[model samples]
Target: MGKSTLFNRLVGKRLALVDDQPGVTRDLREGAARLVDLRFTVIDTAGLEEATDESLQGRMRALTERAVDMADICLFLVDARAGVLPADQVFADILRRRARHVIVGANKVEGAAAEAGVLDAYGLGLGEPLRISAEHGEGMTDLYTALLPIIETLTPVDDEPETDVDAEEDPQGPMKPLQIAVVGRPNAGKSTLINKILGEDRLLTGPEAGITRDAISVTAEWGGREMRIFDTAGMRKKARVQEKLEKLSVSDGLRAVKFAEVVVVLLDAAIPFEQQDLRIADLAEREGRAVVVAVNKWDAEDNKQAKLNELREAFERLLPQLRGAPLVTVSALTGRGLDRLQAAVLKAHEVWNRRVATARLNQWLTGMLEAHPPPAPGGRRIKMRYMTQAKTRPPGFVVMCSHPDKVPESYSRYLVNGLREDFDMPGTPIRLTVRGQGDKNPYKNRKKSTPSRLRKHLGKGRADE
Candidate 1:
């Protein structure tokens, strides 16, 4: 229907993937789009197709329907070249019943041949159809005209005087929402957990593995803070990911992890701490994102105490880089232990953003050096002068030393661990760099010259002279 093309044009970016194949877009992607002077959130949905309730296509259709219900106005597009088929009429009927406002668009009308199809759209009983060429950038003025009346009715007018200026301001104004990505291996119950958090079955979930093929984001509020949660597709080992679509899905999930401030690595309690799970956790840590390990399917586990002990031991042994990170147990099926998960997420985010003052950091460094001094390589004691925090968002530090290259990895690890313990900054990635005092000697290399004639004459005559 060229809906994605129009979506790209309005957003001024190719956010939604387009292809000659139908149903290329299987997810509802939302973007802030501008058309002339009107600005609104536009959702590009999957092409309407007929399928059963259990098939993959059926789930895609279900997601599209949910998008329609959430939208204020629906853009019902039809291919002017292909004309209105039975499927178009069926979808039009559904939209007429579901959407509050409908704007019928006959797309691909770049030539006179599409006139007959443009007329055919009127028979769907959606009022007059607006002929458009989304590819050629034509008929946008008409679209703006059609949307202006709706926008005016929807935007509220303020008549009362503002008494409390601060109260009138946006509550969540100063801070950006926390971006969280929920990632895990296949059948790890990632979607179910997110749906529970949202208090709606916004994401499709089932017993089947690899059902999700896109990284979907939904805005939510948890503990009086705004959050944008991403529900990513389940990842499998690279060797097992044979299909092209699955590869794309995994790539998308990895991209989400990179963009996120915090990542929740969901694990199946029945088979917790698998090799793939460790890989995912390590990836999040390496990417410098705060990580929280969530062991799901707790309701099914009979030996809770032993299982928890096993989980803790495995977490320590397998991924020591993320030591002391929050390990939460949850049951996405029954919404058990969700509060703890939320608390852990918030706490990890706080720790990730922690900044240590220079005074406190230098004091801590002094104590660390006094407790166990740096090693003397080749009988030369490496003098440790001072230390200061370079930046936050993982807490990076720079230390002035006699020789930066001589600082052993073991000593660096010790300092990092001490900093983590002293500052109460556990689980967050820490970076430590060593720098040497560069070239303090003024006359490093002076050219040798013969003595001056006056000095030679003043010197007493010798046999060699």
Candidate 2:
């Protein structure tokens, strides 16, 4: 049971995908783990399978071996509820040879049903197995005790005094990793594209529609930029997603989109934009994420120019909200057009984060007001006082005016489209909110008439009286 349950518990977040399906987690995920007073980096890997050839399971096994070789200590977890199986014994032998130090642990040992399995774990010859329940947070003290000594021995008690290196030496601070999430419908080459970017078969891919269940994340340096990329599960229609597992997978994908700064919506070359594809793109846009619509598998297309033009046309006509967003065509299979895709993503992110000066905003607003004056509704003029950028990273603006409530939706679109064209925001979601400046005197809500006692006192104090 090398599931990410313990990893999630230790990291204190549902960072890993969990389900009843075997091999749900096909990639290695690392997280900063905290065990009460102890802190360490934990790497959760795929389950150990006995496959040895070049099949998917075999590749997974090879990846796990790499993780084992790199780890200072390996915590080999076995399913206590299932008892010690032959596969467990075989994996134990492999770890003994490959891993430097191994600690055996029996996971899911919450009840008496698991006691026999815990006893059976002794046969692996990896020494005493800690009876722990990763889901219930049981036997954690015992686990803490087991790891304390090994951790102490390995980690130096004291090292060189740390310096404020970034704060003092570097003019600019550490670069923040750009958060990007690749989302699409089933079998749209999302994982394949990411695998090409990584230059490795890090994520499992096959002919199957939904081979990936978890929205896996990995760190990489792409196009000379550090990034944390999320590969989410394929999202199908809501009616089609009836199973519990699929629902969870879709939800995980959504959470990834929410966390990402740039959302790359991948479309299959064969079926460019399905109904589900539109929904996914709309979801990212509604979430205020910078959207980049990419058409994948371009190598298969014979009439490349025609298809490109058609896709661009469809993008504009379907998603006008993302009027200026970049639509790049790429082939994940042969890694064609990846450079263009990279440049497009970077440009989209730039536009998403671009902030305008208040003076420039006001100047642009004046031109817009002169071009199409706001309509006088009910014989009351809705004067737009001024405009200022309220925030960046999706670029929200506030327009102070006389009658914000009376502003027409069409006028709001006009201002938004103007911002996109004038400020070069393009495909990024721009938030334009109108806030009304008070119509009359400022103290309209205060008591208009004076209190009786106060008026009497004022009269008595008058010099004439």
Candidate 3:
């Protein structure tokens, strides 16, 4: 009953939205939790409910079931004040069958009023239920005790002696696995594509829209490189996302995009480049993430060549900010074009992490300024003196200029586009910042006092003396 409260207590922060009303949590929310000396990922899930397979509640139940399957241990909670209800028994049976490890918690058992319910929990055939008052912070010691053995077992034992080895043996070794997020509008086959990549039903997928509400991450090896893929909930237009749960789902998807190094904007070929799709792509670009556009449902299209041409044109016109980004046609349902998708993602990630040598950057800058000198706003010429790369992940640069603030945004865009074209970097966000010479010059505005003037002043003083 107080699952969110207990989750907040363990996580040491309020992450889940808790209310007196049931079903406030419709998605699985996870956070790194600490209990005394133990640390693990804790998931707060929706309250157990019974409904037909096609109902919305049933879909929520399916998500909870998936969470249970993913969990190492499930904390099955019951309302001790209300005793064991029939729904409690139904869900307890589910935990027994589905979950590998379960700890039954009798919540709200703060006083003698809950004693009878605490005893009744033992009859549910889950091991002895721990009486707990999640709101009052009770029974945590008992929880730590219960979890200690399991935690010790799960923790890997370092039996071998540590060896001294060079940590930075390879300067140009393989980079960390790319964190890729697949994002799109509702029913755009985000989950289907992920499932296809995983080659298993690791994620729950169906014909139903909004089936996925959580951003689930799974690791896979693709094309001889490891990849961490996030399968996020389908996003809808802001006006259409009126319900609270749907709003949370959309925010969760946005968070996935922010955490991602590369985002694959999956568009349905049947209805490619919708308004919502453009919004998602724009958001990714603003977040400075490498982007790859994948047109899904290619197998269902009758005129492949014409549709491909149309998609290319639409991509260039609708999202000019992400111009020259790889747009690959795919059928997530049929597993077609998956190799190309993976290659595009790798390429985008490479470009996203690209760095330019200072010499090369200045060379490019020289040519750019020669081609189109910066505008002289108010007739004050803006001289760009020097340019160097400031940082990489999205390739940020800083230019020393006579008047940095006076440099127009249009000129910055020109330089960014130039870099993108000259460096063969496409579909990756580029940043440029201008810095003014300012008062750094030590001799600026300094006047030289001639010897004659000094001698004249000195003579006047001598005469007064």
Candidate 4:
């Protein structure tokens, strides 16, 4: 009943969102769990709603059953207050049939009221019910004791590598998957596109407006490259996002964007450039994440050339910040243009982390300055002494100059666009900072104390001032 809460407790982070409302989790969210001495992977699944049809609940139940098949040990949680229901019995039977090992837990057994439910759990035929308060963190010792033997039997070696399920790949080891966050408005085929990439239906998808609530991450190898993809909830305009749940979902999507190295803004081909779409792309750019604009549902487009031109024109006119960013077209349903999308995402990440040598940067800066000199404000020239890259990953550069505050935004844009063109660093966000070198002399602005009258007289006598 408290699956997400228990998951957060075991993982020691609030990775999954929790609400009084059920079905907040639609995907299989995995986390590396640590319970005292035991460390293993734990999955938070959707509520077990019994539906065999292709409805959202049916899909969720299927996903949970798949997880059961994959999982080594299953933790079956039943609400202690509600006691064992018919649904709980159904789940118990399924677990007994499919699961390799199972532990029945009577969750929310915090006080005297849940005692009967705990007793009811004994009839579940899955051995003793571990009474645990996932919300209050009680009965954890019992949980730990129940899981230890299973873990010991399953674990290979203690000295082996401590690998986390969601670990970002290390360049020193195997190939590191590129981190990608796919975002857009409601029903933009974000999940559908990811499912195409994974070659399986991992994320729930249908005609519903916003089925996804959490920022769900899944790993895959696409187009001959490894990738850790995050499928976030659809974001809507602030005015339309009146519900608390919608607000939470939008905020969660924004968090996924921040964590991503590249954000793919999925646009419906029918409605390519909505106002909210521009805002989403701009948000990614402002956060310094590389952006890719992808138009989905291209297979249904009749006037493909006209639409492409229109999309291109609008992309440049509305989002100049993401100028030269990749605008790809793909049909998630038909799975067209996936290779191009993959290539574009990888290219954006490469540009985001691109670094230029200081020597090259200065050389380029000198040429730029000669070509278009800094403006003279009020007959006083703004002297730009030198420029050097301060950091990469959405490359950041600093210009040392005199009266740097006077550097106009227009001129800065000129330089940024110039860098993007010359260095082939398109699409990824670029940060340009102008700073004046501070005065070196410690007492340049001060009066040097004027050697107060008494001190001056003493200096005249002893020359010690």
Go through the candidates in order and give each one's C-alpha lDDT: 0.88, 0.89, 0.87, 0.91
Q: Roughly what TM-score does model 3 have, to 2 decimal places?
A: 0.84
Q: Estimate each model's TM-score.
A: 0.88, 0.92, 0.84, 0.93
* lDDT score of residue 439 within candidate 1: 78
User: What total of clashing residue pairs does each candidate reach?
Assistant: 0, 0, 0, 0
Clashing residue pairs in candidate 4 (N, C-alpha, C atoms within 3 angstroms): none
List runs of model 4 lying over 4 Å from the truth. 156-171, 441-443, 448-465
Name every residue pair that clashes in candidate 2.
none
lDDT of 3 at 235: 89
Q: lDDT by residue for model 2 over 293-356, one digit each (tens)?
A: 9999899999999888888889889888888888988999999989998899899899888989
lDDT-best of 2 and 3: 2
Scanning candidate 4 in windows of ten residues, the lowest lDDT window is: 164-173
Better of 2 and 4 by lDDT: 4
Using lDDT as the measure, what is the rank order of every candidate, best first? 4, 2, 1, 3
What would the per-residue lDDT of candidate 1 be over residues 325-355, giving only the tens digit for each residue? 9999999999999999999999999999898
Q: Model 4 scores what on Cα lDDT?
A: 0.91
List the lowest-lDDT window of 10 residues for candidate 1: 455-464
